[model samples]
Target: MGQQEKVATSLAGAVSERVSASLTPVDEELERRYPGDPGTRQPVHTVYVPGEQFAADTIRSWGDRALAALDEHAPDAASFAAVLGLADDLAEPVYTRVRAKLEREPIEDLRVDFEDGYGGRTDADEDTHAARAARLIAETYAHGAAGNTAPYLGIRMKCMEAAVRDRGIRTLDVFLSGLMEAGGLPDGLVLTLPKVTYPQQVTAMVRLLEEFERARGLAPGRIGFEIQIETSQSILAADGTATVARMIDAAEGRATGLHYGTFDYSACLGVSAAYQASDHPAADHAKAIMQVAAAGTGVRVSDGSTNVLPVGPTAKVHDAWRLHYGLTRRALARAYYQGWDMHPGHIPTRYAAVFAFYREGFEQAAARLAAYANRTTGDIADEPATAKALAGYLLRGLDCGALDTAEVTRLTGLTLAGLQTYAGPRRGDLTPSAK
Candidate 1:
């Protein structure tokens, strides 16, 4: 045999000898330690409203309100026009298109909040409100309002603190009980557990959910929750170990996401109220930590919101839109695909910023992706890691309706099916250039 063939034969023989002599068996526990696959659908943003204000038609009304605000402030989409640097004449047409999209898919997720948005009420009033909110959700589901509501719908319970733990649990129990009684639970129903500072809290919440499933005769683990990383303790425990990872571990495979809370997290960090914003350095650091801890653990991380809401007279509304758009763009740059919207006015800027971000980079990303797929280097060389990132970007863009499948396919020379299948890391059975 040739010298190269002899070297290959020698290496194979050595590996075979090592494998035959090894006494250790494969560890099943280690094999199952990694997290399972993440959810297929992650909403672009979640709209939070007071529990008392929630109803089956709330999302549709929110869209209508947003459309009216868009017309009043920008008069045929002037706000987006300014942001996109389009001419005045194009504003109306652009506004029309955006308005249609808003009317069709008003919100991707909606959270009826009992924490921050729902202020402290008398005990009787709180209980009454909880029951009312539960009935609203039930009626919404019963009357087919689920079709109009966002794909992901749930409520944000009060934090699991000593003072409010019972209240929180009661609200969750009532809301869930009502929904279950209304025929069945809605698909993609999630509970938002705020102010998560310890792993034990996650464990307790999981146990409660298990009890809920048992009592309701629902499928086990049907209810999952998203943990809010709103406090300093949630970043690092007293012992200095990462608390986010611990929380995920404590969740026992039911933690769907980690959502940042801007004001509360900043307040806990001793940040001044004047500077407690989503893009604050301290907030960014916390989010970065969350990203690291949740990476590959199937826990999606979301950025916080801009409380400088768009309200009041025309000029103030314009200013608020500008600020919201800038902050949203910043969040998008930091890879926070999801955020919280406090008001209907924020919707226009949200869609505008997201669409613009995806549109601005489409061509270059497509070119590079195409080059990588075809095994040909383009203007900028594409590595496997960069290719995977490009593919993910396109996929997210498609998911959020920012980029169409045909456009992506035309630009990247890969059909939608092919892009979905072969856009990421290459498998042993699939060739990189085949798609």
Candidate 2:
């Protein structure tokens, strides 16, 4: 095993050693650990990695380096698969397996992209006009030529501030319409309205899409997508904080996801120099709020990109640093554990992030809770007895450094209520997350 792979495996195995050693079935001792109804626990988690997460960038880059190294020893490079595959019968390596699977066959839904706005302009000079026209043609074709089955795509409106100040156009209505057509906002398209200082901005944009969808002969329900929650106003007044909910209500079903407008939101927070949403303290808190607001409802929440943009090759020292620092590793990973892959590259991390977080720690705790509720083995499940057992399991897991509540919910379906009553973590509540 490589040094990095060895580190990850040894750490994970060491953390899960006790559970692995005690594959012991639920018995009297187990019942005492968790007095709960049996057979009630469900496989509550579903994979939530963004297909095109920056993590994908990380994985792909890592794969490139891995393939380069492996090809030296083994020929048939294209068919060789991942580095872990090189080690036959050498299973139980999560990092290598996770990295390989993500790099080779990236999941579908995890991919999300923001469409750049048009830079069209009127110019008297022949050369200038030609340059603008070329850009327009290139972008128009680019959108069309790109692969379909979009993980998710959001189109930003061209600079309305410039349109208003320089060209004296106020509403951006005509410009937006033209840009939409140029970008091919056909049926089932999700449009993102940026720089929205007020709810009305979003509502008006929502109306445009509704009208456009109808004009295009697209079924109304065949549409209804989402937008990014980026602007300073939107971030400050998240969900319950402002007219954001009203804007969402206006969107009808067209609004399905909300992304933290990291850079812009951070600027609003008065950070001296602008930084990407993932880096700022405000971004973290805002993301939590947005996440909570979208929770339970079907609306998905996404964290903004690392805007530091992967420089150099993947698996490089810088990429590792980005993973460690620039990324909200624990929070984002926790969300992944709960089945929300907010970024594309994050999808691969989703598997490990989730399994490592839950595995025996979350799952076992939940299973023990379920076993406690079962009276078939003759012990009754009462508030007093069950709470003690549940508390005992939680304290032990917490002491051992395990704190995933969503898994607890899966085990008992009673976690939320318990959380509300006891003020304990629910649904992987490392801290009050999901705005």
Candidate 3:
């Protein structure tokens, strides 16, 4: 006590204050621009149906069809495991969770596509279909039909190109107006701006949404959109800069995600139809760019869909299923965490691969995160960043029904809130206890 009391501080408080004053703006900028993940539940896959083809029973029909595909081809856990090369220990749990997910929530996010999926149509016809889609979606949400509506639902309008700008805007206006008139927008409403080629397009979208909000008396920035990276120009500008990053900035905090467009992006790179898949080098390059651009911007990245459909004979279906399963698993491992399902038949394999990935890594991730939270020594010396990742992994597994609450709690001795604290920001504030 005598020695400690005799010490005098050499660093002055005024110096610390001056340093902080110099860095205050940068601190605020970082906090405002990159607040990290929103800690919301992200869907596993988004299922797209043509605007005209979407109906109230669309979700239910997809679930039934997926279940039928499983029954006819896989038939049991062992067969399904064999087809996807799932581990023996994971076969039963993964298969059971896949079946349950399909039955309970076949489609987490649903996009009624008016872009390529709907093709060209007269302006009046497109407008009518847009209104109809909006009305059906609103009605489903209003009626509280859990099985009929996806957790997130929206439409994908045409690109803002010279030829289709007016049409796309009109469709968007009609659909949004229809929702406004139909008891207001649902909580899970999402929108996608497809084929964005420039940062100005994202800016244009923000202005459009602002105008819509003003016209409807809604709060500013209430509507957020996913930017579809369909064109190469969206990735790299004429000046050779990363246009996608600029697009996110141009969004003004309204960008929810960056969704890769498989065929369009691949074709832009001159990839042949046979090779224009999610795992193609071209596709990977674009998505990787998108991933980097969206890294800390509160915007997510989603992989694109495969054109291959799980149809025809059992052998053909099995082959398609295997391909889809493998691609989904690969995307999951890469941390894309979401993809697009073009067909109802893709649902079975989508959930199967997702469940397998989460369950396979569950125990290890939980243990490591638990150890980090408790400040205990482990095989791997995990830092704060890794603890955050591990927490996120388990949270995703829990969110998508791959990991049961009881099991997660039992394994980690942490509740959902505790896990969220580790997953969320403020890692420096974490103590050596499972708070």
Candidate 4:
């Protein structure tokens, strides 16, 4: 201490004070706009069911049907592993975890699709279905039975297009009003505003949600929604600017996510139906822009779905399963983290790919994070930012049933709080010698 204290800086303390004062507002602005990850457990995928078909047993039915598919086609861990081409070392663990996840929490998040999936019904029919969907969701959450309800539940209403704008608002109002009457909205409640093309569309959604909160006596900004980026104009505007960035700002701090609409978006670019896919170059370009725009805004970006359903003969189903798995795995590697599931049959391969992704990287990520936190020399010698990424990877693994808490603690020598600290904004403040 004596030797360190003996050294003196050439600049005066007043200079630093002046610089800090000059940057105070800038610092605050940065913090407000970019708060980093929310440090919550994000769902691995979103399952969309047509509004009219939603029921009390929807989640369980999906799980059961997926399990039945597994039973009839793959039948066992080795067989399932072979179908997906899982590596030898990861086969048994991934298969077992996928089956368990399907048996347990088959749907992480569920959305009642009142848009394309529901198509155009009479106003009365739509109204009836919307209320029914809300009632069913409320009942599911009210039961509070483990594995009985998806953690997050909501409805994806029609777009803000001039033709459907009022209908979308009316449906959202009915759905939220139903939830309020049931027992207040669940903490895990989610909403999606689909086919958003312009910044004003997002602003209109915010105002609608604000009006709903006032009408229902819920807290201001209590209701948030995903912005469905289904059009090229949503990504890039006529003025030649990144329109999605403005869309996020237009959300007024209420946008929860940016969900890619695979088919709609592909169609907007005039891709033939046969050529449309989540992995298409257009999809990648759009999602890549989306990823960058949402990097630190706490707004999640979800990849779109594969329309190919894993059904029919075993061979045909296997082909579809492979495609889904490959797309999911690819999306994960690109850091999309969440996506859409169109069919019950897609559930098994979804979990399989998600589980295998985390499990395969578990050991390396755990070691790297542990080394960073403990200040140990390692092969990677990761910096603070890299450490944050490693910690996030491990946390996502833990959140989605991919990694066990006890095992993670044992491997990393850190508690959940410690890992969260590493994954969060204050990570840079952690010194090399600090745990």
lDDT winner: 4
TM-scores for every predicted model: 0.87, 0.49, 0.95, 0.95
Residue 426 of candidate 4: its Cα lDDT?
A: 42
| Every candidate's CA RMSD | 4.9, 18.4, 3.7, 4.0
Q: After the best TM-score superposition of candidate 2, give how far the Cα of residue 43 lies from its true spot, in angstroms.
A: 18
Root-mean-square deviation of Cα positions for candidate 1 versus the true structure, in angstroms: 4.9
RMSD of 4: 4.0
Ten-residue stretch with the least lDDT total in model 4: 426-435
**Which digits, one per residue and each the tens of the lDDT, describe model 1 over residues 1-435?**
555543334366778768755733444433343543353557779999888777668888988889888878886566568754644654554465467657777787888889989988776777777677667666655564422656677899988889999999988988888777766687758789999999999999999999999998888878899999999999989999999989988998788899999999999989999999998899989999998888767678888898887889988888898888888888899888899998999998888777667777888898889988999955788777788678777877776666777888899999766666654332122111111
lDDT accuracy of residue 383 in candidate 3: 97
Tens digit per residue, CA lDDT, model 2, 1-435: 555543333365566767756655645444433332221111111212211222313323433443443333223322222321323222233344444443443332321221232233342332232233223333433542222222222233332233332231222233234434566433323333455556665566556656765765655644444445556566455454654555555555455566556556676668666454464677767667666655544455656644443224544423432352324345535462122233333343333333334333555555555565443232434454555445444532332223345656666565545633332323332221111
- The regions of model 3 sitting more than 4 angstroms off are 1-8, 425-435
Each candidate's number of clashing pairs is 0, 38, 0, 0
102-206: candidate 4 lDDT, tens digit per residue: 877888999999999998799999999999988898899888465567778999998899999899889998999989988899878899998888899899889
Clashes of 2: 38
lDDT of each: 0.79, 0.41, 0.88, 0.88
lDDT value for model 4: 0.88
Model 2 regions lying over 4 Å from their true place: 1-93, 107-191, 237-241, 274-279, 308-328, 333-355, 358-362, 365-435
**TM-score of model 3 vs. true structure:** 0.95
